[model samples]
Target: MTHPDDDDELIQELALAGQGIALVKMEGRVFLRFEGVVDEAGLHVPYALVPAQGVLAKPSKWRKLEREARAALIAERANERARRELDEHVRAFVRELAEECEDAGLAPMDFLHTLADLQTSEPAGAIFDRIRQRLGHAVERQREEQHAERTRQSINLAEYPASFDVARRLPRRFIALLGPTNSGKTHKAMEALAKAASGVYLAPLRLLALENYERLLEVERHGKPLAVSLVTGEERRLAEGATHVASTVEMLDTRTAVDVAVIDEIQMLADRDRGAAWTAAVCGAPARTVYLVGAPEARRAIEALAERLECPLEVHVLKRKGPLAMEPGPVRKVKNLRPGDALIAFSRRDVLMWRDMVAEMGHSVATVYGNLSPEVRRAQAQRFRDGSADIVVGTDAIAMGLNMPIQRIVMTASIKFNGVEEEEIPAALARQIAGRAGRYGIHEEGLVAGYDADTHEVMRSLLKEKPVPLNTSGFAVAPTLEHLHRIAAVTGETALAKLLKRFIHNIDVPDGFFYPRITEDQNERAEWLDTLPLTVAEKFTLSLVPVTTRVASLQSAWEHWAMSLAKKKVTRLRTDDYVLHHMTLQEVEDICRLYSAYAWLGYRLPEYFPDVTLAQDMSREASSRVDSMLQDQNASARRRRPRR
Candidate 1:
C-alpha cells in the first residue's frame, strides 16, 4: 500500500512507478504496486496498488513489469530529444519546463526525478550542472538590477520630504550654528527649526532634553502641536502633544522623517560613552535640514564630515551675540560667598554643607545636584533664575541645562570624580561648567571664580580655550540599573561576578577578578548589610548564595529588605568597634576637637561614632514625608489623582 503521510507519498510513488510491477516481499507472499494513470493532458496517471499479504505473485506480473518499463523508456527518450534541440534557447525552455512541472502538480522530489531523466546521453549530474548554471546567471542579473536601484537612490541627494527650499539661497543641504560657550547657538537653532514645519532636536543629556522640551513650549507660536517629546532610559514620551521632539542622542533612530534635525552641543561627539549618537545623527539623519549647534571648535570636524557626504556645510559664526553692557574681567575669589551668587561643588555632601553654611551666613539658598529628581532641579534652577535663591550649590549637572542669569560663579573645587578615578577638570569641562554663569541675552557678562587654595589654576583652566574635540569610539556600554539592583540583592561577591559576565563591560573578564570588583561596585546594599553590625555567622549565612548563580535570588532578598526598611531611619556608621571609641577617648576627642570642617567629614570618620548621618539626623526628610502625606490627603479631598 502507498504511504499515507503526504511527505513520503511522492518518494514512494516515484519509486514504484520507476520499477513498475515491482514485487512486494512479505513474510509469506509476493506483491506488486500499480502506478502511472493518464488524464486528458496525455500525462500518465501514477498510483501504487500492493497485492494481498498472503497471495503469491502470478506469472502475469513479469509481463506487466516489462510493458510499463518500455513505456517509461519511450517517454524519457522524447523528453531528452526535446531538451537537446532547445540548447540555444535554454533560458526560455527552462522557464517553460519549470512552469509545466508546476502545472503538472508534481511533488518537489518527483519533479526533480523526471527532470533528471532528461539527460539521455549524459548523466543526472550533467543535467543538474546545466540547470544550476542557468539559474545562477538569472539570479545575478536580478541582483544587479536591485543594486543599480539602490545606487540611484543613494546618489539622488534631494532633501528629505521635498518640503524645504535648501537648494536656493542656502546652496547647501544643512546649516550649522557655531559659537563659543553660552553663545546662544542652541537658542538660534531652536528658533530656526521652530519656524520650519516639523523637526527634531537632539540634546546630549536627558536632563537637557527635558530642559529643551520645556523651553520649546514657551517659544511655541500658533496652535501648532507643541507635541514635544522626550525618550530616555525606559521611561519614554513626555511632551506627547507636540509635533516637535527634544530628545537625547540615544533615543534617536531612523524611524521618523522630520523636516529638520537640530543637534545641540555638537562637541559631545568627543564623549566616549555616547559619541556614536552624534556620529549617527551626522551620518544617518534623514532630515532635509540639519542644524549643528555648538562651539566654533567643531567647524573643521563639521566641514570634513560634510565633505565626506558630498554636501556643503553652511557655517553661522555667532560670537557673544547678546546684550553688551557688562565687562568680563579676571575674577576675584572671596573667602566668603556674596548673596545672589551660584556656588558649585562636585559632591553631594559638599553641596549640602555649602547650602547649610550659606544659609547660616544669612543667604536664602537652593541646591542642584545629580541626585535630585529632575522636577526638583528645575524648580531650584528657576528660583536661581528669578533671584529667589541667592545661591545655588550643585554638581556638574547644572553645566548643561537650565538657563540662569548670574553675575558671579563660585566654583568650590577644581577636582572631580570622572566615573572611575579622581582627576583634574579637563579644559572643556572647566569651560562648560564655568559657562553656566552668564546667560546670553540675559547677563551682560559673567564672573567665574574658584575658592580653593588652587583657585589660580582653576581660574586659568576655566578661562583657557577648549581643547580640540577628542575622538571616541562610541558610548561605553554599561550595565543597566536593574542589573545593579539585582546584584545588590545577592549575598556574595562570587554570585555578583557571574551576573557581571552577562554585562557588556565584564563579558570577557574571568570570575576571580570580575566577581569581586563588580560585587563591590554594584552590590552596595549587600555590603552595607554585612557592615551593619551583623554577626560572623549571619554574614557567612548571607554569603552562602553566590550572586552569579541567579540574579533573582539577590533581587528577592534586596526587595524584602527594601520593603522592610522603606520607612525606617537607618544610620550609616563607619567605626569598627564601639570599645575603641571608649578606649581612645582622648585620641577621638582630639580628632573631633580639630575644627577642619572638611576633615571632620573626610578623615575623622573612623574615630567618629557614626561616620555618616542617618535619615533620623535630618529633620527635613521627616518633614518632607509629612508634607507628602498631607498633599495626598488634600488631593483626595479635592477628588483629584495625586501627582506622583
Candidate 2:
C-alpha cells in the first residue's frame, strides 16, 4: 500500500542526506540514474539494498530531482534580476541627487556622504523627504541669521548721521512744488533757477539737464550770455565763467555752496533703486534756496524731511492749464487715429509693431523707449513737437520728463510685464503718462483711452484716482571699505558685498526711511570685482560701471576694459568706432550704453580711463547716426505705404 509520492519524498530525503541515487547527464538530458535494480512493483532499490523490490519506483526519484533542480534554477534567476534592477535604481537616484545638489549650490560629495550616513535601504521617496527636511532646516537657520543681521543694521542706522543733519549745518530754505503732470511744477522751478544769481539745476534725466543747460546759456545776465555748464555722468560741457551748473541728480555736487538749487522729480525719493540720490540731494545740497519739484504724492514726505531739517518749508500747488478726460470707447484701428495721437505700449516689440502699423496707415511715426539714447529720445520728441510726426509710439520712458505735444493718448494694454510678472500699471504712473497728452497751451483738452473694455476701465480708474501718498523713502548707502572690513570681522562673512549689505541694513533709520534692496545682478558684479586685485578706489569705480549686467557681450567687454586698466594698458572700448551704422536699433542702443559706461568710468578715474573724451565723442556720433537711421527708416516706410 506504499504510495508513489511517499516513495519520491523518501528518495529526496535520502538524496539530501547523500544516501540516494546521484544525478547524471546522459544524451543531453539530466537524470537521477543510479546503480540499482527494479523489482516487480516498478520500484528501484539502491545497489546496497537487496530485496524490497515493490516498495519504490526509479521514475519517481528522477522526476522529483528534475523538478527540484528546475525550481532552484528559477529562484536563482529571479534573485539575480532583482539585484540588477536594484543597482540601476540606486545609480539613477544618486545621479538625480547630484544634479539637484549642484543646482542648489550645495556640494554633491557632501550630499552623498549625508545619504550614506542615513544607513538605511529606504525608498526613493523616503530618502528625498529626508533630504528636503534637512534642506528646510538649513534654510530656516540661514533666515534666522539674516534676521539677526538686519536687526543689527537697524540699530546701527539709528546712530548714523542722516542727510538732515548735513542740511542743518547749511542755511537753506526749501520749496516743494507738488501737483499732477502738466502742472508747471518743473517750469516754475526752472524759472527760479534761471533767475538766481548763481544756481544749480539737478535734473532726473540727462536730456532734462541738457535742456536746462542750453536754456541757461541762452539767458542774458548783463546784455551778455550767462554762464552755464552741462555736467552728466557721460558728458560735461562747461561754459567759461559758468556760475550755474545743470547736472543729473546723481552728479549733483553737495559740497559746493550755491545761491539756489533746483531738484527736479523729487517724488523719485520713493524709488527703491535710485531714491537715495534724490534723498541725498535734498538733504545735503549746500544752497541758500532749494527747489524740490515733483508730483503731490511726495508732499508729506518732503514736509516731514523739511521739518526735521529745521528748514523753512514753502509748498506750491500748481494747476493744470488743460483739462484731461477719458475717451468714450476703445480705439480699434490706426485708420481712425487722427494727427497728434500717441499710442503707448509697454514693450519694445509692441512699440515697434504699433509704429509700423500706424506707418502703413500713411502716418509719420516717432518712437521713444528706454533703450534709445537721450539724444535720440530728444530728437524723437522734437519730431512730435514740431509737427513732423503725426503719431508717436513709445514705452513708459515717455512718462518721465519727455515733452511731446499730443492731443490724445491711447493705451494698447493696461498690464505691463515688469521683468518678473505682468501687472497693471500703477495709478501714479498711469497719471504721469496720460498727463503728457495735452501740453498746457498746445491742446485745450487731453483725451485718454485704451484699446479694450478692460483696459479702458483700468485707465479710467487710474486717471480718476491719485497715487497713494508716499510713506517710505529708500536710499543706497555706500560705506567705506574700512567700515565694511570691520563689519566683515564682526559677521565672519568674507564677501565684501555681503559685508556692505550687512553694514547698510544695520543702520537704524527713522520709521519712514530704509536702505534700498541691492539687486542680484549688482551683488554678483560686486562680488566679481571684489575678487580682482584692484585698489579700493578702482574697485569702487568698477562697481559703479553703468553697463547692463544681464548682457553677456556687455559684461565681456567690461571685463576686458577692466583687465586692460588693471594692467595699465591703453584700453579702447568695444564701441569706440562708429561700427553701429548698419546695426538694429536695439544693437545701436546697446553700443550707446557701452559708450556711456566708458564715459562714466573715464569721469570717475581719468588716469585709468584716459580715452573717456574719445568715448564721449564716439557716443555722440553713434547716437546721431542712429537717430538719422531711424528717421530714414521711418521716411522710407512712409513712402512705401500708399496714401489712404
Model 2: lDDT equals 0.72
lDDT of 1 by residue, 1-644 (tens): 22224313432544534544333344443333322232223333232333222133343442344444533433343233333333323333344445644554433234333442341333223454665565556555544444434333332222221212332223236688987667778878888777767778888765688777776766656755466676543234555455678777756645566788898888776565455467667755657788988867677777766764566678999876443221233334332677557788888778766666566555666677764544456667776778766777778888877677766677777788887798887777776777776676666776677675476455665566556753332222233333333333332232333334333332322212111122333444445444444433233223322222223433463334333333332324333422222333222212221211212222222232132233112222322332333223323333432334
Cα-based lDDT at residue 555, candidate 2: 89
lDDT of 2 by residue, 252-333 (tens): 8866788899999898887766776776787778799999999988888888777756789999988877899899998877
Alpha carbon lDDT of residue 427, candidate 2?
Answer: 92
Task: Please state the error at residue 415 of candidate 2 in Å.
Answer: 1.5
- What TM-score, computed on C-alpha atoms, does each candidate reach? 0.48, 0.73
The TM-score measured for candidate 2 stands at 0.73
Which candidate tops lDDT? 2
Candidate 1 to truth, TM:
0.48
